[model samples]
Target: MKGKGKKLRKREKAMESGSVEDVLRIDVQNLIVSLNQDNDGVAEGENAAPELETENLPEPGTEIDVKVVELSSTGDGLALHEGSKRVYVVPFSIPGDTVKVKIFRHVLDESYSIADFISVVTPSELRDDSRIGCKYFGKCSGCQFQMMDYSEQLKHKKRIVEKAFRHFSQLPPELIPAIQDTIGSPLQYGYRTKLTPHFDGPPSWRKNREPFTSRPPIGFMLKGTHQTLDIEDCPIGTDVVRLGMKNERARMEVEYGNYTRGATILLRESTRRIPKNESRPSSSPKARSKSPSPLPPDNAAVKVETESYTDVKTCVTSNTATSTEYVGPYVFYNPAGSFFQNNNSILPVFTDYVRQHILPPPSSPSSSPSSSQPIKYLVDAYSGSGLFTITLSSLFSGGSVGIDISDASIKYATENAAANDLPLSRVRFIAADAKDLFTPAIRRAYPGDQTAVVIDPPRKGCDQDFLSQLLRFAPRRVVYVSCNVHTQARDIGVLVRGLEGEGSKGTRYSIESIRGFDFFPQTGHVEGVAVLNRVDE
Candidate 1:
């Protein structure tokens, strides 16, 4: 392949550590393959036949050595099988991990496989537990990074955010601003306010595991299996939760055979409210704790409630989490198990980032009595539980509108605004179809130089109709919030290539910045926010 009379030398530099760009691609197959190649033992498709017959495929449940080269968005590791014709995913694995795994695949599909970890052959250098490690590190399915150093985990998460944006945007990395460092939780391990510990009926009660015992054991489901790991304490759970479960476990032994099948216990920790100004924009502002005193061990409660949907029984347990908890000055009615952000530690930082971009500081008006109308309106298109609009309504001088496709969400918003004591004159909430969420009154109220729209859609990202309407409305600024960076980048791409008035020009909004908030720590999840500014023709 070398073609040169002068013999040009190839120069290669070692890739910087943890650069996702060098190893990941947008295409799923390519991404899996590249990550698989990063491992040492998983030699890529050496000298194998082009296609293996059904009878020739590797036997299911056979243990083999595989190296995890990349972590999936959901925290699984991507690896490869022999001949490299198919890829396998192993959970509870980090990149650079060489582990023995038992392989299994769907009967009809030989193109993919799933692996269960037998033992770790070589642990990744990123793993750290120098001070102390959790005994449930491998057995429990709760926390993924108990072995990883906290700082290293932060670095990897930032890299994950950057990688996702680039891959989904399908653009050069230079276009997007460098992702900020992951904001860590003040309480890394014991920050969780709620826990759902479960137990399965023994073989005696269920007749599944040969002779069953009828004792209800409490804890998390085992990694890669339906089995539950009995736990007396979980580090990730709050002290309040631990004490609640501890008592419940003792009670379970006394009242044995109460559960005929599988059952779960819900433990919730009651928390105090904090005063609000919690603003973190480009800067990583320190989030203040609500209570100067420590969390009381006895400030916890347990209750059981059952809700059925889609022919499945779901149990939810909630504590006295309330609407008075302030994120900035806004009071959100956070009913237990309703979608208040999980990590209380970084919530102020997260909300402030959203507010800063959505409501920029007021600037001096244009000189010479400019004819251009200055934007005074703010619209929260996807106002879930009214977090954005209520918190920001007072910031906008003219007025604000909050719209939601779900009537329940709008109702919650109304209740929250009233609880926050925000006047009806200052802001209003509307329930309408997302396609027609923005009303003409919005244009009338805030018709000018800098109107802002804040949107936080479900994990799938904003719908196209909403996006198109956003373009037509052409707000001066748009702040898009998403937990899924890939979908966010997809939406960003569409926004970047938006059409101008009557298709007269290209690109209407300039991407101002892309930032990540570490809303969830010790997990794969993160909240990403992007700010886009409309360009005047």
Candidate 2:
């Protein structure tokens, strides 16, 4: 009995690892084991395990017509071939689409094959090709849903969130709340604040290493390949950045020979606030010259002015140069090359959602009735340059502290705090390892009952040690923001289970809500936010 319990626990842990392939593998193995157990009393010849039918598998380079019946979490279309009893993963094909695809590779062990999309014979009702904003939508790897309706895209994203939690959390369906519809970006196109375009130099194997007779592609990578497609303009980039791309490409025309290796050029959008009275017309060269960084000839500049202030937009080329952006009334300055949310239009909405959900845990009847302390302290882990710390400082009466492993990020957070005129007594920035973030000093300063933590980790999600430390800290509430929902689901599962055997005296957490924000609208990417509250049993 104990051995069976250990095996079940291992199975639960396997579910938490979070991948469609992993889940399928486990399911197949479990089925085989169950079949064997059922036939234990029967002769081996009576019910032998069926051999996998590999003879019917499709060959590479073969063309087949398939009707896409479902959309995978990765934004690809899934079609099952009846003849081969195999699933086909076709890119650039939407659910309900009748597509002609060329078989590229087979995953015979999994009974699925990968195919390259040829053409859509019949478009799905959800697809509106006319609505696709970019001409490079089909070839460019940057976007997956440009042909999909905006409303449909949001719906699909919500499904992605739901599927992530279902596949990875390993929790009962009753325990998880219904996921909310994905929040859409205000400006679908012309919203991305940064664009990186690159061009390759002559290959090393070439004997001559001669300069190219013609200019090479200076844009994003092509779909399924590392080679870049020459893109004169990208609709997703802000107008200023698009113009900057053209200007930089022209500059590279003359200087392309100066490099022996390929290089990526950074085009980050910077916004400056100028008093309306002092602002000049954006088209004027003088207005463009106001930038601290030297301007290229015919530099693009855009200005939007209100009664009190004018905001000018320009592209910053230097990675180390300071770039500025405005979220609401608040201002943020980070290194141009450093990581910042590329989608600016949706940040205000995203931050507001976080603010609204950070406090006042739901009342539980079973726990003895006692008035819960109002959450007065905020802890922003993986805080980058004070985006969340400063934006949320006003809500916490006791104080807010931002912690980051990067010392440079901490320095800028402090500077941003000062820049925003936030009272020093009300806010602080700490440079510390996230795993050791909740030290004795922090625990004493901000008690768990009155503190809320907001962790916005990278795409890889939080480390196990850091998550264990977080469980030990046990804040009243936790708002986890992640670019990758798969990782988020795995980490949340760990927190929900409370690190049972990980040498931590942590309690379980109840999930309050889960949702996705459409940070990158045309793409498969969705930013997931999961709110968890301590379960006071």
Candidate 3:
């Protein structure tokens, strides 16, 4: 066996260096000889009947070469062997290709095995072209499908959503229309409005054994890894955000002398206080002794603050101060430490879509009774910083309510409302759990007469109790904004089923429309909004 292995290796090396004619000559002769041997072996075995080919069977953990025959629901490649029971799922692989894979994780109960591809035996047509602009495309892990063409990405995302809706809810195909893709951002690169870059103590600080030695490096966390990737320049971040990171890095190096390790440094684009400073120990003796470094007269950091006509003020901290004031405008606010959509140009379009669906055009007088009231109330549940509530407030003369669990968000929402001159009585901001706020008593306090509820829950979807209360409240319309489609479908299924139940007899809410927003382009993530309207009894 060892001699045969060495001979094979030598032959492979010779083949690599030999001309095409030479390789063909060898193959012809080898095939002729192999045919003769095969004929002889078949003749001998004919009389005894063919023995089972046990000798060639693979061991339990041994990997085998296979051609991907299909794609899994999650877009993984699936491969199978004709006579074998084992099946493999190759990540980042497409169907209609051959790949050499090694099984890494296997469970007998599961139908498919997870594998890591060793090499491509046959490449698929779906293999993506190399990216043109960004060098950090793959390594950054910020965008997975950037290499794929934009059209193809949209098609795949639509298919993913459709499949999730079909498989999870078993909804009729006609009930779910093809996902509507929003216009892709014009500035595909360098379009991010915000960025949070973190840093640890400087190298010199590490050498000095200073008080702060465990600070994280200043930059985005490495893709999938806990280690920080020092980001001196990030193409996706806005200019001001990038500059802020650079300034923060310089300040940390100058003041801390590189002593910190494992500490997180924050560089923010908004005039909103960069969160990193708040993270520092407020009462630490060391903090008291350390004074913030002063900026040079010409090098002062800019700050961008905006106040809406309704009295909602947004303070964004950066290098040069930029402010905008308007009434009946949308203001997006993400958690101080969480990711949020940041495209300013498309903010109006996105909000307009939500508003239209939440409050459709008023019914003609001929279609309804003379006393029918126009939609008046709007409830922006999970309203972070009051973007949805304040922006949509203009549509209703009656008023709106914004509810959230974050106190910081409530403070910002109230200030934002006040800044916009939306009378305090017209819009009330509540800092309470959405579930607690959606109870029977609370719903009664804010009568459902001509009410519309806009719910933008986290990825996990709303809690069961909250859903139940929401169904009981039975707003005239519901605008569900979801970041994850699978959970969205599940929650929608629950709502649909609840509407069919006894207590919900007169509260049926049909899914009027659904649309997909490519907020995080180049990545598989997408945001969707669904409109549901109550059926009059």
Candidate 4:
């Protein structure tokens, strides 16, 4: 019986470890069968449609017909059509333009399509003939609006933001501004503070994946394909960040026997200096030997397990040669196997916008020195690493509080507060769920003190409990920071309606302001900030 059970378990494990090709083959076969059933007894002339061709694939300049459906947040139309299975096209076409598009490359499952707008079948009055500025405009996916006029881009972004708010929040239109603008980037180029280069070769090409034989050559993955485009230059990253990646790639080729598969490389740069000995150990003894004496135990770099598609091995490279960092005051990050804002240049502007909108105006007489009132407090809910909380601590002299569900975030926020020289007594870090902590903690901390709540919720937005708690507390101001405007709107709807079964006293807050920031410029994602004030009446 035990032997039989072991055999069955082994069989199940084998089925679970199927390769990508195996899965694709099954899907293709099923699709082919479905097509055959859909068109039974078709004539040979009609059935002899060009065999799906993979050999001598179209070059970079080839054009094909594409149909677009959805417009990416960057205003690029995402094309979807039948017959051309697993294909998506982003053309210079507007929402309704159906024209010939050139296929850039066949990616893993879909084709990356771009258009040659020689003629518009159905032209809209909104379409303009403006030329883009950036030299690497067409190839680089960083800025989709490069070809679009600034004013048009703003209009498109505003429409997208407003639509999301209306569709998701269902709030009155008058409550929010159509759009909010921060000081635009003076010099768009060389603004990014961090850059990460990906390799498509063997293990030897990476510090952690060293000691392997020849594999595919190394480079960054092309925007639309699984194939890597050998990148010699990046227009956006700082010289030091770019140089560091270049040096690391060269060193990998020399140090390892050959580029091996399943290895990743990490390159990070920050304005905050990594003190001597805080750097990770180097793969090369020569590199390690040159560094200062061993780091103190307290300052040792913490070993955190990073999740990757494959087992990740890391090596550190520091460019001590660069005296001054990038041109702006920004936080640069290249997190391994995760999503992060790539445009580090505009981060300060984005952060400052949120801070200014959430914090009360300095000129308010209620907060002035002549008044003998206690300063109001702010709650930074879902505070990740305490970035917003620590930065805005100066607004509340009596201190403020931040709560997050993530244990790592709580620990980081605590350390960050101490690092920023904020009085620990004034700043309380609670490692608890935001929904559970807000109402009870506020009630316990101050029975009647008016507070302001700045919530930067996750993409899905707040839960029922969270909305309930916020409504219960009825903070003087609720600054909602959201990545998804739809959910933000839905949550706001619940908050605006207030508790059920209660007469007259229901609607607790009134929407005062709504605005959005284009944090992720090239993508369809948007970040919205909404301010709601408790209605005393």
By TM-score, the best candidate is: 2
Error of 3 at 301 (Å): 7.0
Residue-wise C-alpha lDDT for candidate 3, range 1-537, written one tens digit per residue: 445434533432332212222222222233333334565653342113222223334444567787776544343556765554345666445566677777665534433456665666776676554653456543454555555567766666665566445544335667666666644555556556666555545457557655554334566655435666665677666565566566666676666544444555433343222223353211122223355433223243444333411121222344233333221233333344444456554556677777677776565232234216677788899987787888888886778889999887787678767655677878889888866977665566566657889988887677666776677777777898887766676666556545334344334456776666766566666567888766554
Candidate 4 global Cα RMSD: 14.2
The lDDT-based order of candidates, best leading, equals 2, 1, 3, 4
TM-score against native, each model: 0.73, 0.87, 0.67, 0.62
In candidate 3, residue 524 scores what lDDT? 62
Better of 2 and 4 by lDDT: 2
Which parts of model 3 have CA positions greater than 4 angstroms off?
1-104, 107-109, 113-128, 170-178, 196-233, 245-261, 271-340, 362-372, 439-442, 499-506
In model 3, the worst 10-residue window by lDDT is 15-24
Q: Supply candidate 4's per-residue lDDT for 163.
A: 54
Tens digit of per-residue lDDT, candidate 1, span 1-537: 223211211110111112222222232355544445665456454222223224455678888888776676656677655555455677667778887888766333333467777777888887554523468766777666666677766777787777776656645566777777766777777666567788877656555433325565578888877888988887776555566677777878877654566666766554343223322111011223222433223234332222410111111254333322445444455555456565655677777667676754457233323224565778887787788887778668888888877777788788777777677888888888888865676656665355788888777776666766677677777888887776777777667656434322333566778767766666767677888776665
Per-residue CA lDDT of candidate 2, range 145-214, in tens? Answer: 8888888889989988987787677677888899988999998899999999888776661566677656
Enumerate clash totals for all models, in the order shown.
7, 0, 55, 10
Clashing pairs in 1: 203-212, 204-212, 373-449, 374-449, 375-448, 375-449, 375-450
Pairs with backbone N, CA or C atoms under 3 Å apart (clashes), candidate 2: none
lDDT of 1 at 292: 41
**Candidates' lDDT values, in order?**
0.63, 0.79, 0.58, 0.53
